[model samples]
Target: MKRLSLAILGAAALSAGSAIAVQATAIEVTVVNDTAVLETRMPRALSDYGFFTDAAGQIPSANVTPYRLNTPLYTDSASKLRFAYVPKGKQAVADGEGLLKFPVGSALIKTFAYGEGEDRRLIETRVLLHRADGWLALPYKWNDEQTEAKLALVGARLDVDTPEHGTISYRVPNKNQCKQCHSIDDTVVPIGPKARNLSSDWMAAMVKAGHVDAMPQGTGALPVWEHRQEADLNDTARAYLDVNCAHCHQPQGKASNSGLDLRWEQDDPTSVGIRKRPVAAGRGSGGLNFSIVPGDSSRSIMVHRMGSDNPGVAMPELGKTTVDKDGVDVITRWIDAMPEKTF
Candidate 1:
């Protein structure tokens, strides 16, 4: 009887070990590109790429790093969670103060959310895949259950409650519309992830982790949005414009024809919209002459269009459907502080 009991105990221990092994296997993470999916048809579901460890929790899997921009693009004040997934054996390269060049088969994931604390709900996740041919932009809309995000080729509109604006129609840009803000020189390129716009600490850590090849030089610091009051006014305002408008206003961008270069590196006052005239005359110009009029925020075309609710008059024709009061306030403060000048 004692011998029989010992054998049963040993069998139980073996079963427990087997269970432990299975649990460990279940928790192992996998994060990398799906080359076949990238090179071929777009994946119908975001889960098909295996980017997240927990979709509901917004947790990224192994090799996927979460990062934040010093000053992010304001999309109706939506909270954004961003991640970069660089494949094994490949690393991202810093390109001056411009965007980091991700190797082929890498991907960028961004989830836009709304609400506060426990009530926060994810609205959409936009992915930019770096394929052998070029970058591909795809937007995914999260389900009401928050379990999965499915491909939204044509995009969707939903009424979302925002802190600044009450319930408003939030836009999830279609694949084509995604190309508009992301495109530069007719090529879809990432506007964010510029070394200058990123935290120096974050960059250093990435280098230490061997995920990035080198720490970029000449990356002038962009002010932290949360700590902008403590930072220089010029730095704060320029950083905001660079992240929000420069992608489209730069010479290589879709709005290149407008001749307004709001890039952080653009030192020219005229290019930065100090008494610069609008390229065309229309209601979009708000009957104002210059894009920015120093010392006169009220008369500045930038402020008028930015403050306008009219679709035709709003500065950013896409991505924004409501007026950005906080953004307008920042620009207004900058313009108001500028010494009065005339063209």
Candidate 2:
């Protein structure tokens, strides 16, 4: 068995502007498998915090301040093997055997599958390393169970390292930075093709680390606050949608053509336009009315879109790869719970 380390390398680019020097860093990552435990260090830097909306559009800085990074990288028996969910504090680990990593964010990442074993493997994911603290794992799925054939991330830690600048820092990706890509909402609501596998062990460990609240009880839609409304969705729901939907449904987002802006604070059933009758045969099929056909949940186009996997339809348009039964249920309840429509 070969041991490997997964490192997210950040490249610092400097440019001289007039008399001042400007510096920018590009994220680079790599995953290797050899055998034996491996230790890898990623240079780190302290940066003033900035708000970045995730694919879902939620902001994470409010929850975890001071963006940080995890430096050392490696895999373990507990790491993600195939398409598994990424628990809060867990990351994927791998040995050189059947796993392969590619250079994407300037670093080599475990993206696709390889070798005959890969075809038989059920889960796939990229390993994320935290310097000493630990690591986590993530994966993608497209069914409704949200549990079967699913994967999970385990063992993430942050390590200390010295950069070329001689500054000591942890090369860990902060909760917010991780949210930037993995999360659908800024950092509040997590949505995407990838998900956090809510394994009992992983959840318990994260709670012990003080990184999360008690392990989530309900294994459905992202966490939502009590008393949230669509027009007045509570912070949690709004945040989740912002991350999950706004990425494509926003004004300039890819799915903007549908004209439904799912931003938490501004989700308007009216703006979604009269739900277009599902004429074309696709994922959003089987609907009698448009997205929310005034009081008719069964006929609503939005319901159909949320319940599909036909590729050509489905709400997020991409990434989901899995149908969130909990998410669907929440939406169904929300739609059904809406007061009898006047229209």
Clashing pairs in 1: none
Best by lDDT: 1
Across residues 1-343, which tens digit of lDDT does each residue of candidate 1 receive? 6336534544554577774344233324445437633675788888888777556667566667889999889888889999988777789998887788998888899999987767989999999999878999999999998888999999999998887788999999999999999998888988788898888888888888777899988554888888988999988999989999998899998788888999888999999988899986487777788988899999899899888877888878888888878789899999999988543
lDDT of each: 0.83, 0.34
Alpha-carbon deviation at 134 in model 1, angstroms: 0.4
Question: Measured by TM-score, how close is model 2 to the native structure?
Answer: 0.37
The count of residue-pair clashes in candidate 2 stands at: 77
Model 1 Cα displacement at 252 (Å)? 1.0
Show where candidate 1 strays beyond 4 Å. Answer: 1-28
